[model samples]
Target: MHDRPAPTPTPRSALPVQARLIVAVGIASALHVGKLPPALPLLAQELGLTLVQGGFLLSMIQFAGMTLGALLGQLADRLGPRRVMMVGLVLLAAGSALGAVAPGAAALLGTRGLEGVGFLMTVLPAPALLRRTVTEPGPLNRALGWWGAYMPIGAATGLLVTPLAYATIGWRLTWAVLAVLAALCAAGVRVYVAPDGPRARDAQAWAALRHGLHTTLSAPGPWLVASAFLMYSGQWLAVVGFLPTLYTEAGWSPARVGWASALVAGVNLTGNIAAGRLLARGVAPRSLLWTGYGAMALGAVGTFTAGAGLAYASALVFSAVGGLIPGTLFALAVRLAPGPQTVSTTVGWVQQWSSLGQFVGPPLVAALAARVGGWQWTWTVNVACCAVGALLAAALHARLAQQVRAPRPGQEGA
Candidate 1:
């Protein structure tokens, strides 16, 4: 007797039409958020922020983004990414305004947190929404590639923009200007994003939360990927957070650090696209993860050394590695669950740890940097973290390989 057939999984290529729309949103928001970090160190000086306080201030947007990102992401499935993103843009604008006019650190922190909330609303649903939009495999791979590109663009460009703003007006004005850009992002969302109505109106928040929790905790691959995100994200964010400060301490101009940080971030764009091309060709996810983490390790070492030329070379290396991790990691996160029932839930769970890493890393690094009284130890810490990340990636790859189907024998064409 013939055996019963297994349920065929949705081909990665057969994603829906909405993916392009979501990718556009990703690019816009990524650029907006990317412009932020570069301005952070500048904001620190202008606002007279202490190291710890600055880290908090820096983390403020991220924390809100993390916390609200998950919440809104769940809502995105119910309320629609278009609507939620619109609301987030409003919040982003409001928060940016608050920070722009901030007279003290307290006010700045408050506003940054608000911006985080806005960012959360706008960016969280991107993966899910995109997944729903595209249909063809080539487009699906390209769309994911775009989604992956957003991070480094957001992170690196934010830093690169700082000095130009600082030299001309100041950090406060920089905030104000970006606030306007955030508002424009809202408009972009409304214009470009189509309302899909509600997805699963019956799905309650708690139900979704429960779903995400169960799927994530139950799956070793998801948890391992989360751990990878935590280690790499924390290390990279903390390292980048300290870059400008490190430069000044190293007796280089703040301008040099800003430029170098930009290079580090820019390198990530290439890494992400490279990962996408590799992923499309049926490369193992773990290979991408390892290469990304390895790049970070090299960059971390580069960040630690003295001398301008060495710093640039190492930073470029670091950024290259950093770029590759997110696309591969996130792609893995989307598939970490066993079935479609848990996709969003598992993705949200992975995000939870991503946020956790982002939330904690900067402050911990700042505290350590304060104790060490320089950025050397900060860079050292990052190198170690990246090394750990590489190891973790290896372990996850091994485990996931067991669960995921290998490329079929004689299978041709991705």
Candidate 2:
């Protein structure tokens, strides 16, 4: 099996100022209005979709992200992260614009799916860019941390801004605004992100991909990590999925759900930043994964029983943790790749699995809720799922540790 090449560790002075700036903008562009789930139903209705259809609309974005991310990463490894990101940003603009003007439901979903592809293009290479541009650990982690916050921030911002857009110009206009944001992000990348070192170009991307996929598939970590995601993402979305309904259950107005979701998303943004900081402080990747999964489970349990204010508070706590897991886990996934060359491909596989999870999460919770009674039963199922996810995390972490600690043939005597 191939092993990930140890990154040529750089000192702090070597951190690329421009690269940091590019990724920061990349973050802003990728998630802008993307994370606002409240707008999903409205977008669906406008496109004449049923609930199941709307769900697929959302699911396909992730589905696209999963497949596209690895493809984009491979392209990044071959052509360059800079070229890939710029192209992605351009697509982001075009996709958003098209989605805004889409005449029918399928057209809108296709455009959004393209946008998801663009999102992956911009995001999947971010860490690769960081590894390439940054040498020092602290600033690298900080940059990655900031990168993580961008999604939740964008999502929360979308939630905050979309309401006004909906009230004023409508969802179409909101998409237009997103297009503008995407265009701006494209411009930033064009001006800022520098080219990779010549060696990165020499990389055998296809071979790396084939090798990475094979190795990652053979490993237990990927399965464990993927399984953990199934539960964590499932429970997390389940909790979020029923929120508006839950709010209504408590006799709250429609506006209450919006505010609650926004607040939860905002707090969730903090978790991304926290993930970077926590990793910088030197926690093992497995530990962070477990913490994230645990938090998701805990939040499900806590809010499952709470009402009104208490429910929102529980929501906030759980979301923050949920936000942290993606980047942290991505980081770990890369580390687990059989070879540095294959990291992107391996990570893509994980993404494909997560996309599968996104599909499973909401319905499973809904089914459980239907079968049993009340939010408590719903949460009980979610909690159980997440707890299993925790176990998966533990197992993955253990397996990954073995990969890191075991010496390669050449280094055995060292």
Candidate 3:
């Protein structure tokens, strides 16, 4: 039987600085995402937010992604990834600066939703930009894996640091500082990354983009991948977003909760980096996906039901292993795309579902918690999501394997 050739290990030095910078910018963009979890408590107290409203604040960033990820992605392809990313950074900075002065929960929610737009614009074009710049398959795969790590790394950084900033300065000032950092990152992107080139002509670009969108939307592969991401993203965000609150309610100190939750989120990098190396070594994406989902299920059960030490440990394992799903899915997004032109569109589709999961997850979980009077029953949601994700992964694996074993055009007889 014919098989796809395994990707060779790419040395770190062989990866381009430009590609690394793009990942850095992604991490920086994610800092905004991570900033909120730690601050949710203070915001709740100062603004008199209910648990449901907190969930709204947690999910507001997904607003743009849920609504217009594909549209903006097509725009990036037509205009330029770098250009869209720059605009996203500006919006993020503006949103943050505005959020600093938001007088009430409603106003803060509005700012957060706007920031979601910026977040969507910043990340949706990343994979395509990386594809354009990092031409080699091995490096590209590894780079995409690191791209998956951007959230956890940035989120963990925010979880760890935001508490200190809030304690010393204040949430508003901390938010303003992050805004400044985002602006600086935008400048860095301009200096470090090359432009995606002259903008496409309106008619021609629109036609191409429309075609790419059609190709992306019509394919079963994109749909399956996006669905699987939806399953994974919702629970992951729900758990991570509420960890500070969970621990706080358990009577842990603010510093302790901040650092501990950061650790859980940070360890996710392990699986993400490993998924890249495993894929390079030719591990089946299906296996990695199932393993990630399985771990998440078991870990969530333990995290909610077990003793404190065990629960914390389980949370760490849940995050670390759960990392495999996003990294593997990202690698699959590249391979499963209908054509080179549709890579961003495919990623945008993936992000759209991912954002939907994020947008819906926290609020749903919060509502559940509100109804049940605690977080203990939240494991049911995680288990359900993981099961759905596993089924999707199985289907995706079979489809990918079939594609690999199918004959090339000139080699039908071989």
Model 2 Cα lDDT, one tens digit per residue, 209-233: 5555566577666566556555655
> By the lDDT metric, which is better: model 1 or model 3?
3
lDDT of 3 by residue, 197-221 (tens): 6777889988988887887898888
Which of candidates 1 and 2 is the stronger one according to TM-score?
Answer: 1
Model 2 TM-score?
Answer: 0.83
- What are the lDDT figures for the candidates, one per model? 0.68, 0.65, 0.88
Stretches > 4 Å off in candidate 1: 1-21, 31-45, 65-70, 199-209, 251-255, 405-414
Residue 399 accuracy (lDDT) in model 3: 81
TM-score of 1: 0.84
| Residue 286 miss distance in model 1 (angstroms) | 1.5
Residue 343 in model 3: lDDT: 72
Q: List the residue pairs that clash in candidate 2.
A: 2-338, 3-338, 3-339, 4-338, 4-339, 4-340, 5-340, 10-135, 10-136
Better of 2 and 3 by TM-score: 3
Q: How many Å off is the CA of 193 in candidate 1?
A: 2.2
Clashes of each: 14, 9, 1
In model 3, which residue pairs have backbone atoms overlapping below 3 Å? Answer: 61-116
